[model samples]
Target chain A: MSGVRLLVGTRKGAFVLTSDGKRQDWMVEGPLFGGWEVFHVKASPADPKRIFASLSKGWFGQVIQRSDDGGKNWEPIGNEFAYGAGPGNHLWYDGSERPFEFTRIWQFHPSREDPDVVLAGAEDAAIFRSEDGGRNWDELTSLRASTGSGWQPGAGGLCLHTILSNPADPAQLRIAISAAGVFGSEDSGKNWKPMNRGLSSEYIPDPDAEIGHCVHRIANHPERPEVLFMQKHWDVMRSDDGGANWREISGNLPSDFGFAIGVHAHEPETVYVVPITSDSEHFPPEGRLRVYRSRTGGNEWEPLTSGLPQENCYVNVLRGAMSLDDLDPCGVYFGTTAGQVYASADDGDSWTEIVRDLPAVLSVEVQTLS
Target chain B: MIRVRLPEQLRTLAGVGKEVGVEVAGEITLRGVIDAIEASYPMLRGTIRDPATGRRRPFIRFFVAEQDYSNLGPDDPLPTALSGGREVLMVVGAIAGG
Candidate 1:
């Protein structure tokens, strides 16, 4: 049977939601690791049964949980995330040098070919790869070596929040840090180069600096890995040349300052984003929740509000809270700060609240199973 | 055998009850008891203290016979009550969160 599994990471715990292709009914099993904050939960593409979750708390630090039999059972793996190559310094918010520290894993990117191989993007801005599943991790030090001192923390505390792997070529990768801009690697994360050529940020003194831009999120279709869509701190941007250059695409959004951007599973040019009011005001514009869709790539978007809230809805969609499933109609799902998981079975035409009041959702990911 | 107590969260993580008993091989010092606890339950390694710095986590406190030993050196000998198994070493998570 073809079904979909939604791995939702929440402020308190992680939930696994499953439903058949109809996407009408759901089975919610949840609160795994209750009282702990689950940053991200994702499954390996090669094996649907294999799943990984990033669990952390203020008192316990970080713990990586893995499940080989889907989400029914889990075991704690290595939580030791030490910075590689001396754990150097980066610019703090006040323009002072601060030593890089490993806080928690913000997101996990499992290998498309091997379930045992995975990559973790951690706070304090660094990337760690674990080849032996989640038991061991090694930081890809070259990422920090490429002008890390110039990097500074956004309001989100200098975290490497996104990791995008090229489906066409696994060796080619791209990662985005909160205030460090984007970087690309050709030789499998061993070396990296800043890919923020055309990005301009008014917040910085130099509008077009090489390595400082608060990029909220980045998305791309698997077939079209060279083209990228980004939701920046204040603008919606697009790149057509593997992130070598980018241009503003915030054509007609009510507000271009928001998080959570995703691409359609089948349509290479179709994209989705939830625009909040602004960076300071993290809520839907005008108290109406809408997922903006762009059918012709960028610069043109339409609000999808069939089954969404239209009045007094003040929830914020985080950067990692949106995902897409590879079904025929292309299922789009997203979580919000108000603890709601909304799913659109037929692209972004209509939506449904699968579950609500499950703590503040940090991340939402879906796996299309056969 | 030395009895040790962990916080509710650590006890849940270690899959144990309120108190756990472990046989310390060497001198029943604070460090040896912690080492024995970690050896018996590998999942609780980095929770109570940092692995790199070997210092107690800011929110984690250590007590024996109702005396704060968090500031004591790791190698310092705990109270004789712990060595005789009369008092369990209490590992507490400070009351900080609202």
Candidate 2:
């Protein structure tokens, strides 16, 4: 049976929207974690029925949930995230040092080969890996130790929000920390290096420095990991040589400041970005919800906004809120801060609102099953 | 047997009633009781105190016979009423939501 499951993480809980290959009708099944903040939810590539979720409560702290039979039932695994004894500090917004504490698990990357292996990108800028399913987690000390004293927190706090592992070579992994920029590990998270060779950010003190570029999100065609697209704090950039270098691709977009960036499943060169007016005003440009698609990878773009709102659509989309499905027409899905999940089944040509009301969406993920 | 009362949310998570009795061996201190409770209800391991720190979570507290056990050392012996099943030692969320 061919089906699609949209794993959505929201401010209040997690949701699972399932549908057959048609991509028209959906059965929404959640607020699964109920009153907890589901930061990220993902199913392993090796086993679609195995799902992992990062949940947090204000008083109870982080809880890792796992499901064996899809998202139907879940059990708490572990929530103990310790950052070693010293508990180093990162640069604060006020240019002072503050003790680094685990705040949130911004992202999760499950191993392609092992359902038990899971990697979590956490706040205070570090990586934690769980080898025994989601039962326990230990920090990859080298990844955190490699980060020099120059690392600082962005407006969203020091968070390693993006974790991408090379499909062909599992040893090659890349992680992007807010304000701290991108880092790559070639030895299976044992050793890492700063991969911001040509990235430049004027937001920090050192504009042309190696690190401290507020990388909002990074996208690529899973088949071609060498070509990477990034939505930076104020620019849309692309790298052809595996992030060895980057050039501005913010071509004809209305605004370059946005969070979400995604690539079409079938088209390697095709990319999508929903631009906001500015960093402070995190809404669709001019109150119109428009999604810009760059067919040539960069330097050229076309607007896709037939079924989207063109008036009074002031919703903000987070970096991890947009994703793509491997349907024939290539479904594009994203959720907004206003609690709406919209899906475009015709490759961004038209759109449909899957769900209009839920908690404020924090993250969106899709797993294609056969 | 020690009667332990968990918060409403935790009660739901643990799938338990308002009161659950736990059996502890040897001297029934706060640490020993919590160890027994977590051993019985594995899901509540880190809900009260951090697993890494062995210290109480910031917004969680404990109360026994109306006496504050919030700051009591983990190794300290709790009031006999709490350990003897006469009164319930409550694990509560210190902050009010509404």
Candidate 3:
């Protein structure tokens, strides 16, 4: 049966949930890398059978696993992420500078055209690409060494957590690094330029600096990649000019502090964000779990809380936890830190808890199978 | 043939038995056994040791007949029993992570 596959990464391992078009009943299959931390698991849009996963353990390091037949079996591929040493320094907590070091892979984006081509966004803010599937990797060194020297780590390590590929222009890509703002490359990651103009961060000494803005997450509808929306550490922003400039759009909703922001599948103007109380308070506003939708792109908003918890709920949705499936009515899915997966089949009108217990959900991606 | 035992996780990942044997023709040492194991099962590379530096991962220890050879040099001679194929060399994953 043609269905949807939710590739879920968790603090412990990876899980694959399958459901038919109805989106009601789901068959769960996994804890694949059993006790390891599966950072991210995603299927390539070009070929749904090709799935890539990043699994890491602080003691055992990291491993990149690829599955040729969906999630049935996996093989460990290249996890050797070597960094090039150069004259670059990052801002320490005390405002001092430190040399850059390679950490873990935060996001793995496979090519939309070729299944063998993939991109790995790493901690310490760098990009690596593999042309022959995941067998070999070479550092896309220009992204960091050139314009990202002054990058600083947000509470999490300074990591390239988001990679957005423009659907209109195949050669263009945009990556978001914590505390470093946004950067884009026109020629397929050979070179990169800061695309963080008009964005401001109050935490940094210079609110108007070119870099050091803590961008939590950025989202865009596949139909129109130019109209982008971002959830920064302090403000919700929108960019109409392919990210060249951004303006605050944290209009009438509740708190602007959030991590996950996503656009609807069909409606380019509609977006969804779950507002947390603040950085220190990571829970939802008034302990009420609500997903605020901006149908006009930004400024005006309405909370979708019919099937969500209205009281005594204190789960924080992460940056990579929310995703939208391109179905007829559009299925929106989000996982919580408290080990719950919620699915809304009716375009944010209501939701249902799909799964009750699992490890804390880390990242979620949907593959609409034909 | 030098008999080597992998940890539970590594065993499942490498699709091997609890203990697998690798052919080492010359004087057997930690380095020789590791090279033979990685050559035999290429997927096991970079898991127990760093692919670049070849240093044993801090959490993985080596022992043969109750002797911990983890601190010894890579090319250090294997224990008499281990080299003679009488005792199995065990790759241990430390009891870390709560």
Candidate 4:
């Protein structure tokens, strides 16, 4: 089971990567479920053969697709969920009418303890839980209640974009929303509390604000169950007390307003993030793409730009598009909004474009299969 | 007739500075407008619709007024309001996720 499997969620479709343990030759499987935008994709840790994908259908609705035999066959699970009611009665529970309203499942996480328990973070800043492997789902009230009164939508709205569960402790979970900041549940999402004390939001002038901060990605340390890393709108933060409190670890990074974060599968301190322009035009700063690596737990940062394009580059990497493999040396992969995929075998020291001219990739995952 | 507003990217790809206009006789369908647009600008032949299945590409979407045209038949007749120029057809590229 040394071979590495890659699952790519793209704007147009989804792709699977299979490698020959050596990491030299790779097999790419599909543009599966074409004509649908795949926002997030995950391979079940309990059953590597099973894969799940969250897809967006323009204005129709959002759906989840599952693959039991790798990427060979796909099935839509449950009914497609729409964001709002008809037209006028479109106010969410917190009395916010959705502008540019569209139903999209932004993040998906399979329960660390229960294989059937899948958590979904969707548009309108809502969280849904499935107990029967996504065959059915129920909206969790705890998350809906967290949106306080008079909640105004942010740039992406109060979007529930990231959901993370501790591998060592199933009872603990954390979810990051775009404008609502981060919330954690020590009782497996049954109850949640705000965890945005140390996080900073440039959108909000007040540095002491507790909620309404935008978070791009949240990743848990593979070994340390209590340690977690977050790439936020204005800063990168790390929490040692299971998200109870956070501290800024982005001491020497170029900028903090970019998406995408990855933690080493075996090393608790190693992580990666790609930094880009935050406002105005969100392209690579001055049209240059750079992936920053922090090996000393965000204490120090180094730029990894060996094999990436140097000239006329303006691609932006999304949040869930970057990931790491569990292989011995650990392989890193990320996709760009410019429709290209890059891979680095030697940590973040260098890179290579594995696939190009595909649809804009939204998310990427690596599953190991024998 | 279905008046579709081309998104910025599609407008760039089609080499048109502004919206491209096309006409359909009986029914307004993605296939119909796509054919009309490709006929007007052949360079956009395989850009929006897949050459194999003639289905709209993943990033592109069709909207009638404010409603999404997801499950509607491509050849479904344009509503009276849309046909009478009371509404505008939209071919939009949606931005989602992070």
> Best candidate per TM-score, number?
1
> For residues A161-262, could you state the per-residue lDDT of candidate 1 as single tens digits?
999989879999999999889999999999999999889888778867898999999999999999999999999999999999999999999999998899
lDDT of 3 at A360: 89
In angstroms, the error of model 3 at A224 is 1.5
Q: What is the lDDT of residue B92 in candidate 3?
A: 93
| Candidate lDDT (C-alpha), each | 0.91, 0.87, 0.87, 0.74
Sort every candidate by lDDT, greatest first: 1, 3, 2, 4
lDDT of 1: 0.91
lDDT of 4 by residue, A33-80 (tens): 676688888977877767788866553245567888877877667533
Docking model 4 quality class: incorrect
Answer with 1 or 2, whichever has the higher TM-score.
1
| Ranked by DockQ, top first | 1, 2, 3, 4
For each candidate, the DockQ is 0.69, 0.65, 0.54, 0.04
What is the Å distance of residue A183 in model 1 from its true position?
0.6
Interface RMSD of each: 1.0, 1.3, 1.5, 11.1
Clashing pairs in 4: B29-B74
Question: Which candidate tops lDDT?
Answer: 1
* Candidate with more favorable, higher DockQ: 1 or 3: 1
Runs of candidate 3 exceeding 4 Å displacement = A85-99
> What TM-score quantifies how close candidate 2 is to the native fold?
0.95
Model 2 spans with C-alpha error above 4 angstroms: A84-87, B26-28, B96-98
